[model samples]
Target chain A: MRELEERIRREGRVLGTDVLKVDNFLNHQVDPKLMVALGHEFAMRFADAGVTKVLTVESSGIAPAVFTALDLDVPMVFARKRKSITLSADNYTADVYSFTKQETNHIIVDKRFIQPKDSVLIIDDFLANGQAAQGMMEIITAAGANLVGAGIVIEKTFQKGRQLLNEANVRVESLARIEDFVNGQVVFANED
Target chain B: MRELEERIRREGRVLGTDVLKVDNFLNHQVDPKLMVALGHEFAMRFADAGVTKVLTVESSGIAPAVFTALDLDVPMVFARKRKSITLSADNYTADVYSFTKQETNHIIVDKRFIQPKDSVLIIDDFLANGQAAQGMMEIITAAGANLVGAGIVIEKTFQKGRQLLNEANVRVESLARIEDFVNGQVVFANED
Candidate 1:
């Protein structure tokens, strides 16, 4: 977490009021060593949760989720995102609205991946509005699987996502929590 | 390589004559240990290439690319795919046509990620039509970066991808090379 926070401080760019671009290491251009550390942290935080599977959305979440699954010695499932919603009998689908993109996209998970016997942990890059996490939680519920918790790489504490997850009764662990972005600089929550 | 071939034989589903659905491990629901092994293999293969960065497309390619980068001690960059092309001055873009989806999506990489002094190695989940690899190569060329080669997790020998890469004079290393799918069974090109 310290390493991540340091990386964010060094390379992260704050655009406008809330947007934090960590393309240099976290997403887009990834630092694999940092990802390993992030994944190890998530796995350590949820070591006793009986996590049978690690679930996340496609693209950004795959890097962190895969490493977390590796650390936990479990299978990682990434929910596929579709621009247009398509109903399928073999898959559990949920609609997620991205506040940043200002568009609604459907997230889908194959029914065969998650089951009633499995306990799932959600991993994501950024927890902004919590739409992506909510969608994964919906899919996990539909599969009759137990939700262990959510692991976020970079969380915007000022946003509604953290509170939303709390209301849903999901345990959340974020490596780097942004308190606010003021004058093109990031203010982290729980600064050490 | 034998381990990967074994996995393909056991869990891979050949949907039709040509399409091999490896959603169980290679893409959608990923097996992290297997991915680690694949990445280690790729890293060993390209260890002498002086790779400064590992490159791949988003979603499926992130897992392997990150691990490969980790083993190689380099950064990994995944090209962002856009449904609608948006020309930008800060990014190098290439149009890739997905044969399976029958749609063209533009893959973009920021100019800051790929530099002229960097030696990039392309890593991907599969090599079928070579569209994704070709697009990455174009981006590498545009950035004036040195391309060591491509490390493919699975390569269908019967497809035009291998021939296309060969024609392009790019060295390719594939962990699992499928000769054909005979009656829903994968035939490896090199059976050791």
Candidate 2:
């Protein structure tokens, strides 16, 4: 967690008040070594939860989810944003509001992949508005799978995402929680 | 490669003429153990290529790309399908035609992540018509990066993907190459 926090402080770009760009090592371009360490940290944090699967929505979340799945030795399932012809007709879907895109899109998963009794851990790169995490939880709930908790690499604590997830009674763990960003400088929540 | 071949023969489902579904293990829902094995195989194949980065187009390709990056101990860069606020304005963009979706989509990568001197290895979940791979190649070319080769988990030999890549003079290594699907069974090409 310290390593993540340090890397975030070093490589992460604080843009304005809300946006934090970590494309160098977190999302677009992934550092596998850092990813593996983060995976271990998540596993250590959720060691007792009996997580059978790791669920995440595509593109950014896939790398961390894969590493977390490897650490947990469980299967990793990613919800596809676009419905391809190859996907099965039977699927569990939920609409996710994208704060960045300013639109809602449906994220879907094959019903066959998620069993009724599976315990799932949701992982993602960023937790801003918590819309993507909420959508994933909806799909998991629809499939009758038990939601263990959600793990995030970076979180904007000033946002209402944490409050929303907490209201849903979802336990959330983020490696680096941002308290605020002022004049291109990040203020960690724990610092104060 | 035998493990991968066995996985394909056992868990892979053939739908109609060309659609092969391995959602239980490969793309949608990933088996991390198998993915690690596949990663080792890719590392072995492209060991001498001096790959500085592993590149893949997002969604399904992320898992394999992550594992491949882990095996090679290099960073992985995934080209995003949709444009986001986090994406930089300066990018190397390529139009990819999806056979399954029946539409062409633009895949973009931040130009800064991939440098001119970087040697990249493209990894993907499946290689069908090679459109996705071609799109990735275009990005690499645009960035002035050298593409070492491509590693695919499953390749449909019946399709023109292999031939197209061959014509482009790009080396491709696939764990399981499907000769054909007969009576819902996958028949792989004989190993040379």
Candidate 3:
């Protein structure tokens, strides 16, 4: 977590009070070493959860989720943003609203991938309002699978995402929790 | 390569003459162990290429690209299909036609991630017509970076993707090349 916080401090760019741009290393352009370390950290935090699969959305979430799955020695299931031609007809679908895109898109996971006997750990690169995480949980529930917990790399603590997940009774672990952003400085939740 | 070929034969589904879906272990639900192995194979193939960065497109390409980057001990950059708030305004953009969706989407790569001295190896899940690879190459060219070659997990030998890359003077290595799909059987080009 210290490494993640330090990397964020050095590379993260804050715009206004709401957004943290980490495209340089976390999402658009990924640092594989950091990715492996983040995976180790997530696996360590959720080592006892008996996670069977790591679930995430498409695009940004795949890298960290793949690394986490590798560390946990499990498979990762990424929900596609849209149903493509190659995606099978048998799928558990859920609609998620993207505030960035300003539209609702349907995401899907094959029903056969998640089984009732499996326990899933939801993972993502960023958690702002928690809509994507909620959508993934719905897919897991649809497959009759158990969601042991949620793991996120960076979280905006000022938002209600953590509160929402906690109210849903899901144990959550985030490497970097942002407390607030003032002017150009980003304040971590645990920082004085 | 044998492991990948076995996986494709066992889990890959033939949708028709043109599409082979490997969502079970390659794209949608990814097997991390297999992913690591495939990454190792690609790294071995391009070991002497002096690959400083791994380039790919968003969504499905991120997983293998991440693993390849990890194996090569380099960073990976994925082009965004859509403009998001987090992506920096300074980027190199290209237009790619998606035959699956029947539309052209603009992909962007942050200019700062690629340097003129960088040697990039483009990585992707599938290579059919090779438009995605070409688009990625355009970004690399815009940055004045050298594209060492491309590493593809699956290639449709029946298609012109390989020919297109070869014509562009870009080297390509595809782990599994499908010659045809006849009566629900996959025919690899290398199989007798």
Give the per-residue lDDT of model 3 (tens digit) for B1-192: 778888889988999677898999988999998888888889999999999999999888888888899999999999988633344568888888888868788789888888899999999999998889989989899899999999999999888889999999999999998999998878999999
- In model 2, which runs have C-alpha deviations exceeding 4 angstroms? A83-89, B83-89
For residues B62-116, write the lDDT of model 2, one tens digit per residue: 8888888988989999998853234456888888888897878889989988999
TM-score of B chain for each model?
0.98, 0.95, 0.95
> Among the candidates, what TM-score does chain A have in each?
0.98, 0.95, 0.95
Worst lDDT run of 10 residues, candidate 3 chain B, spans: B82-91
| Candidate 1, residue A81: lDDT | 95
Query: In candidate 2 chain B, what residue range of length 10 has the lowest lDDT sum?
Result: B80-89
Candidate 1 pairs with clashing backbones:
none
Q: What is the Å distance of residue B62 in model 2 from its true position?
A: 0.9
After superposing candidate 3 on the true structure, give the runs of residues whose Cα lies further than 4 Å from its correct spot: A83-89, B83-89
Quote the lDDT for A180 in model 3: 92
- TM-score, structure 1 vs. true: 0.99
The residue pairs that clash in candidate 2, if any, are none
- Of the candidates numbered 1 and 2, which has the greater DockQ value? 1
What C-alpha lDDT, on a 0 to 100 scale, does residue B57 get in candidate 3? 94
Evaluate residue B188 in candidate 2 and report its C-alpha lDDT on the 0 to 100 scale.
Answer: 87
* Candidate 3 TM-score on chain B: 0.95
